[model samples]
Target: MSDIEDKKNSLIEKMGSEIITLAHGSGGKAMQKLIDQVILGFFGQPNQGPLEDQAIFDLSAYPNHSIALTTDSYVVTPLQFPGSSIGHLAVNGTVNDISVSGAIPLYLTCGLILEEGLLFKELIEVIADMAEAAEQAKVKIVTGDTKVVDRGSCDKLFINTAGVGVVNNSLNIRIPNIEVGDKVIINGDIGDHGVAILAARGELDLQTTITSDCQPLNGLIQTLLAEGIPIKAMRDVTRGGLATVLNEYAQGVNLGVLIQEAQIPMKTEVRGVCEVLGLDPLYLANEGKLAAVVPAEYADKAVEIMSKHPAGQNSCIVAEIVEDHAGRVVMQSDFGGKRVVDMLVGEQLPRIC
Candidate 1:
């Protein structure tokens, strides 16, 4: 073997692995193993071993108060799609996730993975879009890393971002707060991101432009919180879509949820694409939107406050928490039939953000 090949083999042996696998993306035990053995072993600390969605550090002891840190990676195919691109999606996704936790996103670290032979112009455009989105979200990209892989070793481009945000004093959002009789509301139409990606890839024949619903939702959430709306829990509907998100909340609270088919807002184009593709809109992805649970008394007021914001203008009360059928998501069909919506067992669309 050549000297380079021998050296690469030696390095792989030392690392005890030669290639990556899909388990790295799974959120299950295999994913945890990969993180603990490879990722965390290399860079994580003892305090950060128990992985939560975001890292919580006691900044109060350090004189700066408390802080929340989160990181995410974007691997959506066809970086440029209708309404938004991977760049903006990355920023919005990270910012919204942090914001829903009652934090004000402050700074971001960007990491770019570029494939050899990828066009430089395209890369510039993506970065420019990311910069603009970050500006709108009121977050700064403070640091970053760049790496290029050989042709065929990587996708055209992928982005990883880590964000730091300060927790707001007045808000206390948590999953356990979701209770029976709590109203479930969505910021806007669902499934826009998935449909947009599908259409962009020519997977659907529909000609109409159904752009992605990708945008920073921090402003909308802040507006609601400012109005003193009591939010029990809030989560952005991204991968696995609304169905998976609701199922998670229901399971966490050991409660049942009932959603109205007529009340859920969805664009005609998106609905059409889903119908043609034999896809369930509920399982499709959305990047810019969120689902919030609030008490019945605060529901109307919350919807009013949400409607005033552009991002939440189309917001509607889609469902309600119930004591019956604990840990299940039941939907009232348009035909007056009740159906159960469960978590997505497998990937409906791979590499979809």
Candidate 2:
């Protein structure tokens, strides 16, 4: 049989019947057939150097900087959402994790798990999305791996990405660096990504036009660093949303995080949906938003710079690091009341990037 026929017979082996063959998982002929064609066709770039087991990056330019590495897996359901896709999350999620560490993102590595019955069309669409996202973020997909599984083993697809970035040693952005009286700032509105996913699922029969806020934030971070504003700590608000992120800072620094409910940014549609659904928007996940604690002296300057940037047009101070109520997160309600914002107990939304 031809090599193509062998791959079709082994890699795609009768979908529901022993779908995962040795040929597909054992680096056999079937899997190798896909390397040059499928993987390279989508991820190949000019001047990528010779193919090898790993990517080699010259760090001579980063003399006194530190290298930052982060990895994340994407299993977001409905693969394609209103404003983003699993592919976008796979790239941007990893990028933001590095950027939030006050690093300059450089390269990325992708690993994909493809089910036996997944359509090439859908796979190609996702690969294209990842490539486009990487290009836009000014990062390169230097190396990657692909594997196939049984028809029912995994959902249609899953993507794992590892990112590399460099951080200046002169800067110290960490939980320990967060000090009381520092101002907490957010780039823009929150809860859009979570709401968009819920609306896309069509499970609640809800109606709204909220789109995912997934985007790379490296540019914003670079802008802040360029201006010489010192950042106490930064975190990409994902999975647990802004409330959980704030609670982390509170617990990390053993200080109080006081956020005004009225000062938090949100769209009217998102707020209304959360109210109707009995869901607190603060706990809804965000993709593009970030919560930053900056020195009191540079708080306004940071906000001013962030406000002018594309990613932070709605920038505002939503919270303050305080000495009162140590190791706690307190929110002054919009209705003249105060409440403790605890860390999320269980998963509010699963498979959400």
* Top of the candidates by TM-score: 2
Check candidate 2 and list the clashing pairs: none
lDDT of 2: 0.87
Worst 10 residues of 2 by lDDT: 11-20
What tens digits encode model 1's per-residue C-alpha lDDT throughout 1-353?
Answer: 64323433443455443333443344567446544443333234344344554433434533433577899999988989989999898899899989989787877877777776665446545665776688689887655555656778888889999988887665678999998999999998999888888878776465867888999998998888878888889899999999998998899999999989999899988887777778999999999889999999999889888988989978899999999999999999999999999999898888877
Local accuracy by lDDT, each model: 0.79, 0.87
lDDT of 2 at 180: 81
Error of 2 at 208 (Å): 1.3
Residue 332, candidate 1: Cα error in Å is: 1.0
Candidate 2 structure quality by residue, lDDT tens digits, 78-173: 899999999889999999999998899999999988887776556655776787788789998889888888878999899999999999898888
Q: TM-scores for all candidates?
A: 0.81, 0.92
For model 2, the superposed segments whose C-alpha errors exceed 4 Å read: 1-30
